[model samples]
Target: MKSSPLALGLLALGLLAPSVRAGLTAGMQEGKVELKSISQLAFGPEGVLFIADPKAAAILAVATGDTAPASGSATLRAEAINEKIAALVGTKSDDVIIEDLAVNPISRRAYLAVSRGRGPDAVPLLVRVDVQGQPELVALDRVRFARAELPDAPADVAPAAGRKGGSPRTESITDLAYADGRVLVAGLSNEEFSSTLRAIPFPFSRVERGTVVENYHGAHGRFETRAPVRTFVPYRIGGEQHLLAAYTCTPLVQFALSELKPGARITGKTIAEFGNRNRPLDIIVYQKDGRDYLLMANSSRGVIKVAAEQITPAAKSITAKVSDTDGLKFEKIDWAGVAQLDRLDARHALVVRTGAGRALNLETMALP
Candidate 1:
């Protein structure tokens, strides 16, 4: 549960008039959108869907106009969602790849970034799940949309230096989120210090060079700059906005939102090392009993719950290496086989988890 942005707050309170909200797309064009690939998905005010296209090295903001307010208490459960999506698209469950899931806060409907096939030619599809747990394709054939291209994205070719085998451009934009009117993108860049984070102001402006980030990876036992942030959530610490970012070979690093400037290099404060041989998949912030908490899903490590109250401005940074996980205590959750997760509402979470016969099921559960 990343902190809801101001736009969301206003929309929830019915303070953002339809005319004022339409201003968010004032400069945008309306037409068919051709996406090279869809890597990440996020939502902004007035039902604007932010789609990250790594292959094209661009971000497309589309006016989904799905602003129908939802009953916050409603829940959704679509079992074997992958198979269902495959059936809907005339494919097999194994061929349907669910790239990411995002819950449109206003609609309380789930949107999934899906790859219809598994090769380079795999078609990208944006599928929306209704409250009745049904899957439907979001029509992007003709829509009001705007695009922002990264000025310094990595080349769309080959294995990058010091890497085994994978397209550098594919990881050019690993994760992005809309917060405080800006879309924060994290991934590799073409610069010498490649791990970058860009805070591109919304409404489709020119994308500037992102702030290069480096952190002390305890598992690797040294400082690193190439490993991109796997997943992160926007949070507030000491009355200022910050990103609680997690990286591969897990390191929980903190970066002030204000410090992210064009062409600047910043060393994030490493607060915790969850361990090596693990990749953080997704993270969300939620509150229970009036205290905030962070729930993160991992590959090797099970879902872990961190008391957000522990993350303070005075918390010490883990500058030195340790044998395993260290700094900022966290408790493992009982959730199993969770591949992706997002907050469906304040009280429920939408998860794509493994079920019988290796099938992926989409279900909503009470926030743990």
Candidate 2:
């Protein structure tokens, strides 16, 4: 197949993408990674990928070394790759569903969260695709890993029927982020009454069930919700660091890390509202001209770039609706179907984008 002009241009930018700069670490030694359960994933410091396990109530950090994805990797169409993955796991193409996508900054390889079927039969598979665009099983046997279990498990509300089959075991983990020696997790319990965040300190010490983060939304300064953060990246404004979290109906709220103490009820400052009925997929903090920007991917409105400085001195909350160029203006990127994204380095972001004919393509592109 011949490459279209658009594909060629994207390839050219990919060639110039930034290289991984993470330092090496002692890859897995003891404390095996139990794949019995998993919901969310995020790359932490020292080439560690934090895996959230709510069943055993533990989070695992596995060592993945610094190997960048092949720079000019030819596209590996999602349909074809899914077939191959199915073959490896003894299933047909229709039986597998790609739940999530994340790229390792250290390896440049993409990780795919897959379910064998759904509900109780929904066995999860962690697969990695390399530069050649080949799918490989991320075998968990004998890898360096550390685990930390959440000391608290709140009661469950009746789960939403699993994906067509009600696979409630794995759908609880909504998002994960790593920053400042802590792994921040956002999840919804079975009860679904409220959402929660967990800041697990690395080196396997303790799990801190984070404070409840609520935001004043909609008009009239009311209509708050405990909707879990779908995806987030740590951002710094001034001298303080904060978790820039996105909730359902799409409100971008910031919660200071210092104030997220255990059992404390905290409210996040609503900085920007993406739109109503929108589900935010991924977010990354990027910089240009020494100015910072927050890039968010959504299920419907495409990818958007928000000026980070707007939030530093923002209103206490944005209670009204915003048009595209209104308060905390958002400029949408022309690229469509970005299911997940992560900053590979300063100049580029690794993305899982929708390909022609319902396929998924993992590629690196210039930062917007």
Candidate 3:
């Protein structure tokens, strides 16, 4: 799975695609709606979907064929980790934040990345809950984070500054994915603009520790490299296990899982870089009619759709314009926090957008 340096160099240049393009159609007809601050999202077996609202400290269950007022058709379940996670991390029940949620496909279990900062009781933990209603911190000791370096800061104060700085180092895991019998976690370093990707082996009953797969510097290739990653989705492309990473500051970056295994160098080619200057905030990959498509939610623009084939090397340039059904032009709304797009059937999807306060928007869109 080794990519020649020549191919990798070409990838670096190909990543810089202009944001200006025409043909994007927007409107309520395209299934656009307002939503609360959506912190995380995932689709369950069948047509069931889940959205995590960390600000609300609750997970909402939305049934199929639902739209706005998702709270009506959605069952809001309060996270049970309020007290337990707090005790484990030695932080206030309110501060023991649940940053990301990962569902195990095999065991049907759920894992949460809980961060407690730097207090005596503050120990970031990777916690898991099985289907039988049992919950425990899985990889507590394996979780290690280097405080980002800050300007004119003392060594001891670096970690604290990094935690307070920006999107990258917020002292929490921004995204998590379960694949190939392992758990992948992405964390941001606020003081310095960077994020680290770590992998934890699965089947917790057998292993007690996980290894740091890659200590990725946020700005390794592009000019604005430190933009913290907004989403990481594991997918198999062309019979190889690869990961599609979307940054809040840059376009998408792809890497083979083999390149991330222990002792492997951190060199990944930029497969496809799309979206505007505002940074792509969310992304999801799903199959429709036996074809794969990458759906991206941008902070400046709305959702952009691209077929998997359009991103391959042969395509050269992938282009699409957003437009309404009536051929009218529509502007992208101010998207906030976290959002998710999930497959509904062969031709449609369920989109959930969450923002500040209690705002939550849900819509159903037909794929083009």
Q: Which candidate leads in lDDT? A: 1
Q: For residues 78-184, could you state the per-residue lDDT of candidate 3 as single tens digits?
A: 23444655665555665655554544322333455455653434444456554333356663222211111111111354345556643232333466555664456
lDDT of 2 by residue, 1-368 (tens): 12467756766777422211112234235644666666677877555777776656667778765444446433333445666677778987677777676667655567877777756557767788765667888877767776666655554355655346554443367888877767777767665466677676555543343344433234325765555667777887667888888776557877778766776666777777666657888888888889898898888878889888787744456655457323477898876878767776667777777776745666677888
Candidate with the greatest TM-score versus the true structure: 1
State the weakest 10-residue window (summed lDDT) of model 2.
16-25
**Per-model TM-score on C-alpha atoms:** 0.86, 0.79, 0.49
Q: lDDT values of the candidates?
A: 0.81, 0.67, 0.45
lDDT, ranked from best to worst = 1, 2, 3
Candidate 1 lDDT tens digits, 41-118: 988877889999888878899989898889648878888899999999999889999999999888888999998899
Model 1: which residue pairs collide?
Answer: 1-284, 1-285
Task: Kindly provide the TM-score of model 1 when superposed on the true structure, using C-alpha atoms.
Answer: 0.86
Error of 2 at 61 (Å): 0.9
What's the distance in Å from true for residue 123, model 2?
3.0
- Candidate 2's C-alpha runs over 4 A off are 1-31, 66-80, 155-171, 206-220, 313-316, 319-326
Candidate 1: residue 88 Cα off by (Å)? 0.7
